[model samples]
Target: MSIPTGTVTFLFTDIEGSTRMWERRREAMQEALKRHDTILRLTIESHRGYVFKTVGDAFCAAFTTATDALESAVEIQRKIDKTDWGEAPIRIRMGMHTGTAEERDGDYFGRAVNRVARLQSAGHGGQVLVSSSTQELLADNLPEHIVLKDLGSRRLKDLDRPEHIYQAQIGGKEEQFPQLKTLDIRPNNLPVQVTSFIGREKEIDEIHRLLNAARLLTINCPGGIGKTRISLHATTELLDIFHDGVWFIDLVPVSGKDGMWQAVAGALSIRSETGIPLDNTVIDRLKNKELLLILDNCEQLVLEAAETAGALLAGCPDIKILATSREALSIPGETVYQIQPLSVPSAAEETQGEKSCAAGISEYESVRLFIDRALQIRQTFVVTNENAPALAQICRWLDGIPLAIELAASRVKMFSLKELYERLGDRFEALNRGLRTAPPRQQTLRALIDWSYDLLDEEERELFMKLSVFTGGWALKAAEVICGSTAPLPVTAPPAWRDFIDPDHNYTYKTEGSIATYNDIKPDLDVIGLLERLVDKSLVIANQTDGSTRFVMLETVRQYGEQKLNDSGKSRETLKRHLHYFLLFVENYMTQVEDVTQNIWDTPIREEYPNIQTALKISLTEKEYYEYGVRIISSLFTYWQYHGSEMEARVWLEQFYPFPDYIQDPLTRTWITLMFGWILSSTLD
Candidate 1:
């Protein structure tokens, strides 16, 4: 008989636990194997099916129709159930799938064949499992004695997607053997996490609730913020609720919207036949089933992911989607859960006297994560009074970001806790090493920030690169003054403006009558809109303080932006603008320091301390700005005295003031001498 091509139904059969039976009774097992082969082949042939391949006690066959395949599977099971072997009983498990395959050399090969074999493996002895495609084809054509029982969706080995499995129940003795082996099984495709999932108890519960409340929930967070891990933990916890099976579709490998549905189809094991449209096949197969789909890393394909999710939610009422991206999908019925960084201990908590070894460290999620991960690299590692503060500082410096913490912790094998704390000053270089299995972006602190940075538009990228000048965070006015450029920008500019204009080119600027040169045009930079966009993208975070909004970049993100600034050779120019702006700010605030309310005066200065220190350091490096640094330092005397930061003030004063260049103006010199004497006296006593 010739092999069938095009759309065909495959029936794969195997003896359940045949190896044990063969070991128990070799002679009887041989007879049983012979009978099993004979019954399966004869039934398949009688039902207009051809037995293509057989190995030992298993048989792989193909039929032209699902009716014939189901009939053949049932007939084979009935014969095995009733056959009287001399000393042993034989039971066979069968599975069938209807899909198009190529006919070559009297054998077939394709996803359909692989799927049918997996379906067969998902069943128990005396049971027949069929793919939803084959079951749908059977429709009203199944024999009266054979009924299809829905076994629900299952993830088979080597298949990217979950398959909706059904079992064929034959009447009489074959009707009752044991429950289908795959019945209690839940489809879990999540990668096995090597390390324990620490912290996020509240987040896990909240995400679970959101998923239940909303059909489409997207976990929005910046890279390395643990969105994927959180979503997996939540999905794993809620697996039993999704009767059809929980499926994980990684969209990182998928490019655009064109491939989104195909990725989903692949994850669901829904292969299209010769003439059928894949999207239509996916919708048809999933419309009635209840399942959860986890779409990971959708930031690169946000629009496509959103569109596909919208389509799926619209058509499939019972299907729920949980996606992870740096931004939201923005579709109707979508719940955007912004994942925050792990909790870090406050300065007060860090300074609190140490109680004991590993004491109170678990209270902060970030600290707990760091400790746990550090122990992975150094098995003897433990948090004690001596190292607890350093650990807290490490977590805080990492902004409690899970990936950052893990990368930092991985270095415990090579560095001491105090050394790690000290090295965080160069965070990008310190936290560069990451697990090899992680995505390229997640391989290092710099790479993760670079991934997010590369996704920005031209204007956003420009703003991000310049905003690195600020140390802690910046007010809108400060950012606008420092980052905004009044000079003309090229229409088609390179990554950095410095890269576009070459000194050798000698391209003289000419504002001619008819055509203006590239250097004569200025692009309007919308600082507000760009900052808001950065906030939306999770690159910048905004905080409302004292009736005004303050924008801040996490330390890791700031380091990344600063690196970009230095690479573009804009560090000095940007830092000049920053120093000039803050110098003017300090001079203006000096007169009001006495009359200003304690809360009001202290808050702004304390917040701006990091930027001020950054500016002062930048100024001391250059002769032209040395006076600006001394003047700014002298102006903050009242701030330091009032805020009880005299020791810190003394340290900065000693570091910069004791330099060679003497004070120029008598009044300024007198004020600096007096303040310096007072701080010195306080410190010496």
Candidate 2:
């Protein structure tokens, strides 16, 4: 028969121990080859298949349908298993996939063809494997007595997407196979995943393309976006491109330049010369090695990572780097790919019935990930129609973030899905699950944000906490107006406490081990400069809308900042300032609303409404800011009445009916903002 072309099933077969067979039994192998060729050629043709190509002892065949291809594979395996070749017995491994093919020069070729070959390479002797694409076609149809068993998703070399494989098991055959040799086919230090990777096939392909195009590819994502997992998955699929093995260098512990190069050296196990610098030694060792190096957690040491990557590329021509960071290193010749949160099903999808809900979740990445991870924690966990809505809402509440989803999923052991859904209203505390094997920063939701928070300078951290006063997002001008606080300069230059106990300057070292203490005079801060650094570090997200920029912190991030503000004893002052800022903002906007030239206040109020509402809440509730809240509510009283808010201002007004108290404490504000012993890490430590 002529070769099967479009929409055909391709089969690839190889001998498991062909090389050893040829070396050990040269005389008997010639006879064994006759039987091998006869079995493959005859069995494949009998199943209405076409033999397109043959390389060495490996046979490549095609069939019009997956059933025909699978039948051919099963029959061939059984025949080989039963054959009595005595001393030169051969074991054949087969792989198959169904896809459209492109035939040229009397031979079929395409991605499907390449995929089948890799599928076969991942199997063992006397085994047959089928891709999900093929397995779907053979859903109920079986090949004789063959039974199919799922092998899960496996990364195949040269394939951008990982393949979901099903193994064909025959009865009466002791069916034990070693780990399917996919990523392990190459030498790499990638971590062994404990759970099946859930989604991000498109992202993995994009990352692979970016790596192929750029020598240095930095994956920039916020904390807990699964950038490292995606990078590792993508890197595993492209191991064939690297000659020397791929290496993973974790930069979490590498804070300085020396630690950076040494981390690289440690990853590559490069030996250093006595007189040569470690950086030079690392560069020299990798100068001629063709490898892929994954630098994980570069955000903690962004500068050092940039410098190390730059120096290595400047010296090593054949080395490539893949880095994951919360921020990008703006170095030349670097390609940055920002990873977004996984997809979540829309609210509309959740409204449908259970059948539709399951379909909806399967179509989205975030829900699938949550389900996959939840299974590990509680095997009996299954999403039912009654609870499916809650599950979908949980993903939405977490904003489709993978880390947050995983953390929430881990709580399946303790709480039901509905109970877990209720807790998401305060996700920072609810989803603070920790994995002991993870880095300290990755142990909890707060710790992850704290990593970025600690990296900020004092002013940046201060501004970050102050900016949390607003909700949704804030404008630059708004942040400056509400959050900016400049330090007061002293009339006389008083040496900081560190100077008082210094032996060289003060000669005040009273005795040995006396333990000198010192306090610092914090430098003046500018809002504009600190905001830039905060955005660069990924603690704050900046977006340009209608030629104007808006800055935002993630929900959990904003919560952490709020917690920090509360702990610092600055919440009252900050809330009063927030109250005062929005009070004036509304009073000015009311003038615009009164203008017949402008239609409605909706345009200005729609985006900033949340912030104003937050400010109003603080004003109404706080004893000191009662009048500020009264003014804000009074200004919007007519609008709220006209729009007919479900809960009228009257109801909310009743909650704060009692006259609030006021304690004016400008002295306490100034007193707490100074050099106190609260900051304990200084001078004599």
lDDT of 1 by residue, 1-685 (tens): 6677889999898888787788799999887777777777788898999988886788999988889888788777667778887777887788889998755447665567767876786677878888999888888687887778776776554355778887787763335545344324566556655555676977987998798799999898877899988887677666668888888898878997769989999888888878887777888899999999999988887889888998898889999999998888888998899899998877777556752224666568898778767765776666667787888888888889999999999999999998999998888888777878788878998888888888898888889989988887898877777786554222111011011122434211111122112222233578888888898788888889679899988877887888888898878888887887777666555544443225434456777878888889888878777766777776665556655678987987887667535555555555556667778887886
- The CA lDDT of each predicted structure is 0.76, 0.75
TM-score of 2: 0.67
Q: What is the C-alpha RMSD of each candidate to the true structure, in Å?
A: 20.8, 19.1
Residue range 1-685, candidate 2, lDDT tens digits: 7778779999999998887788899889988998899989999999999998897899999899998898888888878878999899888889999988766545664467768987997888988999999999999787557778998987775466789999988763549986777875467877765455656867886887788789999988788888888887788766667878789988876779998988888877777789889998888788999999999989878888899899988999998999898878879999988787888877776656743465446557888788767766876677766677788888877878888888888999999999999988888778676777777888888888888888877888889998888899998777776677432212111111111223223211111112211112232457778888887777788889889899998777788899999998988777776776676666555544532223334467767888988987886665666655655554554455345441556544544444423323333222222212121212224
TM-score of 1: 0.65
lDDT of 2: 0.75
* Model 1 backbone overlap count: 2
What TM-score does each of the candidates earn?
0.65, 0.67
Worst 10 residues of 2 by lDDT: 509-518
